[model samples]
Target: MKSKITVMLVDDHAVVRAGHRMLLSQYENISVVAETARGEEAYQRYIEIHPGIVVMDINLPGMGGLASIRRIHGRDPYARILAFSVHDEPLYVTRALEAGAKGYVTKSSAPEILVEAIIRLAQGDTFVDPEIAQRMVVQTVTGTDPSSLLATLSAREFDIFRLLVNGRTTREIAEELCLGYKTVANYATQIKSKLNVRTTAEMTCLAYQYGVLNG
Candidate 1:
């Protein structure tokens, strides 16, 4: 018999983790090998277990999922990650993919969709929730979506940008990201310059306009 595919679950909620475990357990071909509640721990666990697939949440306790995905994919180029996030916004999807996730699925998706995404990613295929995929395609064709401009930001820059728009101060962002104050401040300035925004208000306005932050 073929060996089952191993999966690692990374989310901050124990309840969510338990629900996922129950859902995935019904499949004979997939097994939950490990779980972690923080992004930093996710990378550590990934290195140790080397699970066949990683189901990661975007809003993690430490470093955040985008950072974790970047770290894991940076170390192991073949790492297969499925981003399971509450964020249905196109910006989050774009940044998650940019950060090296093999697939993106919203939390609101049916359980079957998540299972199908995991199987597809395990098979080296990319998957995106159909609604998000269609919206992205429409945006691309209409040339009206702000995602093209947002895509210019690197993974780290994008993370900083999101925090900045959410009213996270430089010091707070630095602390949350575990970066030096000066470095985060500099990134803030650079991000503003890249986005051609003069102030945090402008940044917030742009974020709201693009659905980066729900109004």
Candidate 2:
């Protein structure tokens, strides 16, 4: 008999997790072994469970998914993570891959794609959503890097950048990210300098231009 592939699901929404759990349960060779709502808890749970694969969301509250992927990969270089996100922008896909995710799948993908991604990751293969793959190819061919400024920001800086562009106040971001006010201020300054935007409005504009913002 083939051993079932164990998976850890990390998402903020309870209903979403439940739905995925049910969906994955339909497969005889796959099982969800653990679940978490916060990105900060993902690495810890991974350490405790050591599941075969981790399915993570990118826009998690607190440490955020990218940071969690980095931490897990730092601890276990061989760890396999599949980044599942609603953000289909190539920037998000690129960042997730750079963070050590073995695969990237958009939430809008067909349900079967999620199963295919999980199975592929379990077998030590990479999977990317077809839509994202096409976009990445176009970007590569055009030589137009939509994530130029985003690529320059370090992981921490990128975390702060997302919050800032989403209209979070410095204090609010500091509190949510558990950074000192001065630390967040310093990161904000660095992010602005790297992006070459003097104001938050400009930053928001850049995010919109790059398709970071949904609307």
Candidate 3:
């Protein structure tokens, strides 16, 4: 008998998690082994349960989904994570991939697409929503995508950049990420230097122009 593929669901919404569990349960070969509403707890759960695949939402309550993916991948290089986010921008997909998620799917994707993504990741294949993949291709070919502008930032820097552009104060970012205020401030300065913006207002403008600000 084939062993069922185990999955961990990480999202901040109880109803969304329930919906995902119900949808994934229809597949006899798949089972949800664990679920959580916070990225910090999700990593701890992954360490404890070690599910076959992780379906994570990028906009998590604590630690953020990108950080969680990075932490898990750092612990287990073979870890397979499918980044499920509401943002359809190619930049979000790129950031998730850079953070070590094996696949990216938007919330707008069909239920079957999510199922297919989970199965494919479990089978050692990567998957991205077809629409997102096509958009990425188009952006790459056109050379107009702002993703290239921000690609130089590391995963941590990218996370900080996102927070800074969204009007988050240094202390707020530190509290959210559980980092020291000084460390977060340093990251903020570095992010501004990398993006070539001197002021938070300019950073916000750049983010808005590049479509990096979450809608």
Candidate 4:
């Protein structure tokens, strides 16, 4: 008999992980080998398990999922990663793909979609949520880049920027990201300059306009 495809799940919420585990358990050919609640643990877990694929949530507690994907790919360039996000913004999709994720799926998508994505990714194929794919096509056709400023952000900068716009104070962001307050302050300055925004309110407005923040 063929070996089942092994998977590692990374998400901050235990409930979410449990739900996915239960859902995937029904599939005889797919086996969840390990689970982690923090993005920082993902790389180490991947190193240990070397699963067939990693299903990662983008909004993790520490380091975040995008950074985790990059770190895992840094260790194993051929690592298969399927980014799972609550945000359906094209920017999230583009960033996940850029960070070396093989597929992208949203939490709002049907459970079957997640299973299908994992199957395809495990087979070395790229999978994108159909709705996100449609939006990506529309975005390309329009040629208007609402997320242009956002795209300019580096992974760390983007993480800080998101926290800033979400009303996280500089000290709060520093603590959350495990950065020195001065370092986070410096990133904040750079983010504001890069985005040409003056205040957190402006940044929040931009985030909302670009679909970076959900209502």
The model with the greatest TM-score is 2
lDDT of 2 by residue, 1-215 (tens): 99999999999999999999999999989999999999778888988989999999988887888888998999998988999898988888888889999999988999999999999988989999988899899889998876876889987888888888888899998888888999999999999999999999999999888877631
All candidates: CA RMSD (Å): 1.8, 1.5, 1.5, 1.7
TM-score of each: 0.93, 0.95, 0.94, 0.93
Q: Which portions of model 3 miss their true places by more than 4 Å?
A: none
Error of 3 at 53 (Å): 0.8
Residue pairs in collision within model 2: none
User: Residue 198 of candidate 1: its Cα lDDT?
Assistant: 90
For residues 1-215, write the lDDT of model 1, one tens digit per residue: 98888999999999999999999999999999999999998999999989999999987765988999999999998999999888887778888888899999988999999999999999899999999999888887898676677777877888888888887889998998999999998988888888899998998988887777621
Q: Which regions of candidate 4 deviate over 4 angstroms?
A: none
lDDT tens per residue, model 4, 1-215: 98899999998889999999999999999999999998788888899889999999998876778888988988999999999999988889988988999999999999999999999987889999999899889889998757867889998888888788777889987887789999999999999999998988988988888877631
CA lDDT, every prediction?
0.89, 0.89, 0.90, 0.89
2 or 4, greater by TM-score = 2
Give lDDT tens digits, candidate 3, residues 1-215. 99999999999999999999999999999999999998888888999999999999998865888999999999998999999998888988888888899999989999999999999998999999999899899888988776677888888888888888877889998999889999999988888898898998998998888777862
Listed per model in order, the count of residue pairs whose N, CA or C atoms clash below 3 Å is: 0, 0, 0, 0
Model 1: ten consecutive residues of lowest lDDT? 206-215
User: How well does candidate 2 score on lDDT at residue 134?
Assistant: 92
